[model samples]
Target: MSQGDAQIDFYPATQAPIFRENWPRMRSHAIVPRSKEGWIDPVISEWSLEGAAWEDFHPHAEYNYVLEGELHISVDGEEVVLQVGDSATVPAGKLGRYWAPKFARMLTVYGPNPDGEESTDFKYEEL
Candidate 1:
């Protein structure tokens, strides 16, 4: 497959190099990397972590799927648990946190690149 294809396939148990080697430290990694101007494009992200408290605001909505294990996600004070095979979407403008008492792996899709000119206001909040 040529680079920059609109779609890419991955093997089972395959962790993209960027994520396989740094999942612990980075907790997350995005594949089909996007250029700074590729805001209209979507990116798939793989995340593995024990626990994390995050406050993020984006101009585009985010959709998440639990690849393995489970995640207790809280969005704007609403709590939900996503087990393997489950999915959820956090709309743009919402703030949330994700916690996994045990190690968990998940895949996420953002409607738009999180770091594009259209989303210049995207930032992690202090809360």
Candidate 2:
């Protein structure tokens, strides 16, 4: 799908392509590219590692839907735990932290596509 074209994209039962990876933390699969500025990108992601944390300032709003396991997230000081079938949206420009006790699989969409760059980007601290 390109910019300014009205069309519907289809994905079969095949696997999605992995777009980014950071060992023992998270991996992102690209479902659709954020072809333009201020556009969200659809992605599938996996979070692993017990007690691993991701602390960062989001450049865009992140919408997540838990697919497999549990995800514990902290936005600024509030804590929220999401399980399978739960969905949440982390607003833009917030300091956030995410940790998984064991593992989690999720469908995520980033408004303005956080990885809308020539290569994958990483902007978080591990604790």
Candidate 3:
């Protein structure tokens, strides 16, 4: 079989076997490797933020889906609150910031870095 034909498999997000005991923590499940060429990278990240403050993620394109709980995202001066099952996309070169008022988890898939770089440090004033 071709290298590209190799399939990745399923696994628990946490060390514990029971869902209730392990589902609360943040974790990442790699669906595809970065070496794979495509329009964007696909990844499943489970985030559990316990009252996290605002954090900036500079300029880069991103798409995220809220699997559980809620998240507050600020992109290009626009603020958006996301809940379970909610999804949004941030354009490339646009300033992106995210915050979680309480504990929450999300799945994010992003890319197509036109700049051909991972991330950039851009300065922005508080809105």
Candidate 4:
């Protein structure tokens, strides 16, 4: 089947598309097409923060791929800096935090939950 006609589909970002001229901004778009079953849901998010920090997120599971820039991600107490072309997985029920030193963009997948009832909420501190 032709590229467009095949049952399998393709996304430009999944195959390494060139970043837009105005890259590094807070933006997101759904990756996997939505469905009733909701087996897998992926979102592409870009973060451009000079000194932005996030509150603790207790999620069931989070899969992330760094597309550009650098990010400080902390799970529990240990922290790591993820750069472009890097990937990380945060397990279920873990406390995680994220910050952007300069700018960053990441593709995140949240799903494959067996119970299908996972959710997340942020707890921010007063600045």
Per-residue lDDT tens digits for candidate 3, residues 50-102, read: 45533445345678788778877887689889989998887876667666666
Q: What would the TM-score be for candidate 2 when compared with the true structure? A: 0.66
Model 3 gets an lDDT of 0.57
**Deviation from native of the Cα of residue 1 in model 4, angstroms:** 7.4
Model 2 has an lDDT value of 0.63
Ranking by lDDT: 1, 2, 4, 3
Candidate of highest lDDT: 1
TM-score of each: 0.67, 0.66, 0.61, 0.63
Q: Rate the local accuracy (lDDT) of all candidates.
A: 0.65, 0.63, 0.57, 0.59
Better of 1 and 4 by lDDT: 1
Q: Write one digit per residue (lDDT tens) for candidate 2, span 1-112.
A: 6677968686544343332455445555556545544355454443343445555666677787888788888886899999999988888767667777777677777666
Candidate with more favorable, higher lDDT: 1 or 3? 1
Better of 1 and 3 by TM-score: 1
Ranking by TM-score: 1, 2, 4, 3
Q: Which of candidates 2 and 3 reaches a greater TM-score?
A: 2
User: Considering only N, C-alpha and C atoms within 3 Å, which residue pairs clash in candidate 3?
Assistant: none
* Model 2: pairs clashing at backbone N, Cα or C within 3 Å: none
Off by over 4 Å in 1: 1-26, 113-127
Question: What is the per-residue lDDT of model 4 for residues 1-127, given as tens digits with 9 covering 90 to 100?
Answer: 6777768656545333332334333344556533434454443433333345554453447777887788778887888888988888778788777777666677777645545553556543211
Error of 3 at 34 (Å): 2.7
